[model samples]
Target chain A: MSTYSVSDTTAPAAPRAALTFSNLSGRYGVGLAASLVWLAFGLSCLYWPDLGDWSRTGSLGIGAIVIAAFILFGTFSADYLGSAGQALRKRAPWLLAFGAFVTLWEVATAKFAWLPLPFFPPPQSILEVYTDDLPKLLDSVFASIKLQLGGYIIGATVGFITGVSIGWSQKIGYWVHPVLRFIGPLPATAWLPIAFFTFPSSWSASTFLIALATGFPVTVLTWSGVASVSSAYYDVARTLGAKPSFLVLKVAIPAALPHVFVGLFMGLGSSFAVLVVAEMIGVKAGLGWYLQWAQGWAAYANMYAALIVMSLLCSGAITLLFRTRDRLLVWQKGVVKW
Target chain B: MVVQSAAEAIIYPAVGAELDIDGVSHAFDIDGATLPVLDNVNLSIAPGEFVALLGPSGCGKSTLLRLVAGLEKPRTGSLREDEVRITGPHPSRVVVFQDPTLFPWRSVWDNVALGLEAQGILKTQRHRVDAVIELVGLSSFRNAYPHQLSGGMAQRVALARALVNDPKILVLDEPLGKLDSLTRIAMQAELVALWQRKGFTTLLVTHDVEEALVLANRVIVLSDRPARIKADIAVARPYPRHRGDPYLADLRKQILGLLGLEATW
Candidate 1:
């Protein structure tokens, strides 16, 4: 409701300054320098011969050149690109650091034969796995995502219901609290041998392990969240003609959302660990299974490629969860900063 | 002074239910010990009357208000509204507590709509929520969250939330106790104006003697813990009562004396 008026006079001057060459030099000089470094490395990959006979050298050079072109375009036309260009310009230092790291990695492994060949494959060798084995890697990625999502949704729903029941009813708490305390602390991986024997398939057993990993934190946090709601909140609702169902659904749940999100975050992290361990030990096909297969064949480049994919997958899942939390808890905008 | 129009009269009804508290007593169990709060209290409030209860600090004033609001049943005796025994909380009687206690996740409009939403009539009576928000002078802040509001503004939203239910009995348990003196004075006048316009049976509990005199037609003073009514005095003053009036100042002195404090000023 509070209106803040910006001076219109200063607005025109900002875009005019952005158009000036001097301003562009100051703002984007570092990014341009970083892009040029990448371009040089890309050019060297095409010209220089390697001691290790790395395939996909041309593909790596092309990828680097494309990235360099993006950065160059982003830096020069930052005003035109709007917020995205500004973001890329800001990441100039990180881009330069990454370029330096890749160059060193390439020099150590393929060029000089240092740091052991099988363990530390050059950047181009990892790129070769992507080009040659794209279909299998994509299948593994899909398997991992499906397995993780199925377990997470099941675990989160059951945990939320159990938590609310425990917090609300004395009889349910009495019955379940002891069991939860006894079984919740043990690692889900500890049950792998039994889970594999009991379940119909390796996939089902892995899912059970993932669910166990995700359920414990969610149950505990949600129980605490529900139990700790202010009595005053209930009083207000009751006096306003709210029934028991209304109190639980409308009053208790919305109030405890911040804590539930915290639980979900913890559960997601633990689920990732369990998912990988389950896949490696029991499941037929997933990123973890792919990693194990790569290691068995001594395809270290494939292993490195899978690791990169795994990190991206995990971070992407976390980002999706955070977006949901942000939308649901919009009223808590100023109270917490992510 | 707010003059109620004929159409507004039909909408608001200007008819409050009579309240009867018959030998009501209340106590809380603290650490396995009985803490008696209200002692043998009996009072009858007429419809459309504004009554203020003044008492010593922690003298079961809020406890009595809670009982009236039906948030808690008395240990003994009965409270009735229009001859119906009060057993539990209902929308017909609503209380505004010392703290606003607005749901932080709800916007001002959503918070005000809570009563209707709970009763499952919000879909049909949506205009009532808007009307109450306008009544509290918070229409401009309808979409704003609780955190965006100032202390006084949040309290107004609380009032609007309670008003949306169209309660016959409005319980006020030191609702302005937390406001600064200037806001408190301004709100006291607003409270009086609202009572005049709505004509609900108002039971206000306050620690401020002048606030009681300024807002209520009748003032009931209570004793310390295990509170007993000491005096019930009528304030025969017109609307826009001045704080500097000699009669009000004399009454403030008498009430302070009854509370075991000297009105030195």
Candidate 2:
């Protein structure tokens, strides 16, 4: 029996002692450096005289204290932190750099008024926007989320179906492929003028734009994905007594999924871009609307805050899609990693 | 040792299908030029007989096997299974290609169960999936995806996938051609053992004369391009036959002579 050995996945033997003096210094050195930098910068913010009125000095001190406390906990239970702790320990330099950047951003913008007033509000003023407009921000977040989800789901579903149809059937491809080629290249926002007139409501018009944006990439990729599937699989399935539907649904679809995911990624990127533009279509409450509203009043801090929120929201959606792709495409593990 | 549960899962033993090919001719359109491959090839394979089709490279032996598998229709004549003409691919006759062709997304068990699932018999014959996996000595890799498997293991999965269907006729288009010499030898023995156990009619297309002599009950040698039946040599030896037998050696010499190769060994 010429069997290959299966890899053993048991955790490496734990350190003999719970706490070791040698590794304590080795692991905690960078963490200690980060803590010291944050603590020093935080104290300076409290005591040092500011050129201008930067009101969030107190919060800076508190943020520093929180990070310091986490480092202290990490030092005591390195084993308990496990992989996350190990990552934090390894990324101590980058973390320290980030803290330094925040401290500099505060000093240069808010305290010193270096870059000029309305254009460059301090990080503290941005934080203050969160505190001052908590309710409005929450409403905007909810509304934005509702809009994003509605548009994304509709777009992705329609795109996937259209792609599979066009990819699988030559007849469908012959008719729909030319349309996809012509219209797919056009940006989703380009239809804004016509959409405003065509759709019954701005919401449907906006939704339609997002779907159009998402559907193109998905359709194109899916077509290629389906077209590129090795004919060997169909031959195998056919000889196995598989019906035509089974060949498409089971073999063709699963085989083409990796490519479909690539299209989904493209679609997601375009969806976000289109979502922000679509929200500018007289929507009552969304981050995009709020951004425009705040900018009109010259509350640049509020605009900055909205922009930050949008970044996080889009990133969160992308991360969620990645997780789904990972789960579904488990067979492709290790072959591709992001 | 067979798992009793797995053995119980398989309800039917493979009943070999008799194949009759009468005046079968095939061709291909290569760059808009008609390239004749097979010309009036005829053969009748008895039920449970293991026949090996031997030929030179580009001899169109694989095309012959593909015609039998019903993957392609012969241009001239008919291929019949017990007097019933084979128009298209049927579960009763399966071809194992040179490539393993296991679905990259599917696990070994899933690949083996594909045939049954395709026929909507997976619910009743699910256990046979495990049995076939075990038979291929891949029980531990049942959940492992195709990409994780070695070439030999992948080929075994392909074999198991075809065998689990209990195909009456099994076509091998140089299925073991890509394997390393050592694995190929081991697989040849395993193939013979499998054939003896299941008693399915086998048509193997190969360029390896020694391999043809080792496993086949009858060897059909084919001529190159516009492939004609050159020779049909029957081996009178029984199962577990010796490779170094004087008669086999003489037949090997004669086969080489017909192939226009002098016996240098």
Best by lDDT: 1
Candidate 1 on A119-166: residue-level lDDT in tens? Answer: 889899888888889999999999999999999998988888888889
Give candidates' CA RMSD values in order: 2.7, 2.9
What DockQ does model 2 achieve? 0.57
Predict model 2's lDDT versus the native.
0.85
Q: By TM-score, who's the top model here?
A: 1
lDDT digits (tens) for residues B46-137 of candidate 1: 99889999998899999998888888999999999999999999998999988999998889999999999999999999988877787787
- List candidate 2 stretches off by more than 4 Å: A1-10, A13-25, A49-55, A333-336, B1-11, B263-265
